[model samples]
Target: MDSPEITEAMDALRRRLVPGTRTILGIAGTPGSGKSTFATWIQQQFGPGTAVVVPMDGFHLGNAVIEGTPLRRRKGAIDTFDAGGYLSLLRRLVRRDEPVVYAPEFRRTLDEPVAASIAVPADIPLVITEGNYLLADQEPWKEVRAQLDEVWFVDTPQELRLHRLVARHVSFGMDPAAAVAWAAGPDEANALLIQATRPAADRIIPWEQELE
Candidate 1:
C-alpha cells in the first residue's frame, strides 16, 4: 500500500488508544502471505524506540518436543506451538509495567526458538505481532483475539502463497521435490485453518495491492 494508506491505518489504530497504555496490532495470515513483511513495514513507519515487532514464530515448540509426539510431521500445525506461553507473553505486553520484557525469536536456519531474543522496553507504545493463529476459534487461541486492539487479516492469492511456501521450505534445506510436496500437504492444511479465521479479523489487507 502507499505511504498515505499505511499512515492512515496507523493513525486509526492509534486513535483507539488511551494515554499511558500500550496497544498491540495483530497481523494474521496464512503461511507465505507476507504477514512478517507487513509487520516490518509498520515498524519502519513508526521508527525505532516507538514500536517493536514480536513474532509468533518464536513460540514454536522445539524440534525435540515435536519429534517425540504425533505432531512430529506436522511441524507448523496449531498443536506445534506453545499456546499458553504465547498467551502469557501477550498478557505481559498488555500490562507493560515491567522495565523491559524479553521474548523469544525463531531461528529459521536451525528451526528452533532462541529465548530472550526480542526485548520490548517500557516506553514503546505499539507492539506489532503477526502470526497464523491469532484469530483462531480454538480455546486459548480464541482468547488471543481479546488481547489485541485490532487484528488485520492478510490475503494473498492461493497459488502465489503456495509457491512462496514451497520456496521457503527449499531455502530451509528441504529438497525441491520434498518442499513442494510438504507445502502442498501440511502447509496447505494449516493455510485452510488460517483462512477460516479471516472473518474474525477487524480488517482485511489485500496482499497484492500492498505490493503494488
Candidate 2:
C-alpha cells in the first residue's frame, strides 16, 4: 500500500483501542506471503514505543529440542513451535501488568531462537505478530485467535510466493536446487495447511493491493 493508505489502516486500528488496554494485531499467511513485511510496515507507521512487532517465529523450538525427534524433518510445521509458551506470552501482553515483557526472536542465519530478544513495554498500544498458524483450528493453535483483537491474512499469488520462498531459502545458504526442492516440498505443505485457515481471518490483504 501507499504511505497514505498504510497510515489510514493504522488509524483504523488505533480507533479500536480502549484506554488502559493493549491490543494485538495478527498478520497471518503462508510462508513467503509477505506477512512479516506487512507487519513491519505497520510497526513503522506507529513508530518506536507506540507499537512493537513480536513475530511468532520467535517461539520456534530450538534445534536442540527438535533434534532426533520426528519434528526435526518438519521444522516449520505447527508442531515445531512452543505453542504453550507463545500462548502464555499473549496472555501476559493482554493483561499489561508488567512494565516490560521480553519476547524471543528467530535468527534466520543461525536457524535458532534467541531468548528475550524483543521487549514489549507496558504502554505500547499495539503488538503486531505475524505467522502461518495464527488462524489454525488445531488445538493450542485454535486458541491463538482469541488472544488477538484483529487478524489480517496476507494473500499472494501461489507462483510468486513459491518463487520468493525458494529465493529466501537460497539467500539463507541453501543451494539453488536444494532451495527449490525445499520450497516445493515442506514449505508448500505448510502453505496448504495455512491456506485452510484463511476463512477464519478478520480481513484479507491482497499482496498487490497492499504493496503497490
Candidate 3:
C-alpha cells in the first residue's frame, strides 16, 4: 500500500479494536525503517481517544546499567534493553482484569527512556509496542512474541534504511563518519538478526504496501 492507503488501513485496524481488550499489536523493524512514524500515524488516526501506544523502547535499561556491560557502546543492541522489565510490563498490559496499565516511552533527546509516560486505560483498546527484537529467537526476546496478538515486520531496502539511519545518527550529534560507521556496522548486524525473525511474524510488511 502507498502512504495514503497504509494510513487508511491502520486507521481501519484502530476502528476494529473493541474497548478494553488488552490486545497488543507488535510492529518490528530495523533502524530507520520508518516504523515509529507509521506507529505514530496509527495513534493519531485514533484521534486521542482509543489505542494509545506504549513502546518497548521505554523499557531500555538506564545508561548506568548498560555502561557496565560489554555491549555498552552499542546501546541499541537487543542486549542493552531491560528485557525482563519489558516482559513484566507486557504481561501486565496483556492482563484482561486490569483497569489500566502504565507503560514507558523512550526519550531520544535526553537519551533516557521515561517510565510510565503512557497509560493503556480500560476503555482504550489496542496497545502498540514497536521495536527491534520483539520476535527475536534469542533468550528473553522469544517470550515477548507470545504476548502479541499479531506481529507486523516492516521491511525497507537496505540502502534506504542505511542512508536514513546515518542521517538520524548525525542529527542526533554523532559525527558524520561515526554515524556511517555505526549504521553500517553494529546497526547492520542488528538488522541481520532482526531479518532472521521476519518469518516468525504474523504479517510481513513493506512500508507503503497495502494491508490485506
Residue by residue across 41-123, what tens digits does model 1's lDDT show? Answer: 87887656878999999999998888878797898899999999999999999988899999999999999999999999988
lDDT of 1: 0.87
- Which of candidates 1 and 3 is the stronger one according to TM-score? 1
lDDT of 3 at 172: 77
Mind sharing the TM-score for model 1?
Answer: 0.93
Residue 136 C-alpha lDDT in model 2: 92
Candidate 2 lDDT, tens digit per residue, 149-209?
A: 8898888898888888888888889999999988988888999999999999887777743
Q: Estimate each model's TM-score.
A: 0.93, 0.93, 0.88
lDDT, candidate 3, equals 0.78
Judged by TM-score relative to the true structure, which candidate is superior, 2 or 3?
2
- Pairs that collide in candidate 1 are 1-210
Q: Residue 201 in model 2: shift from native, Å?
A: 0.5
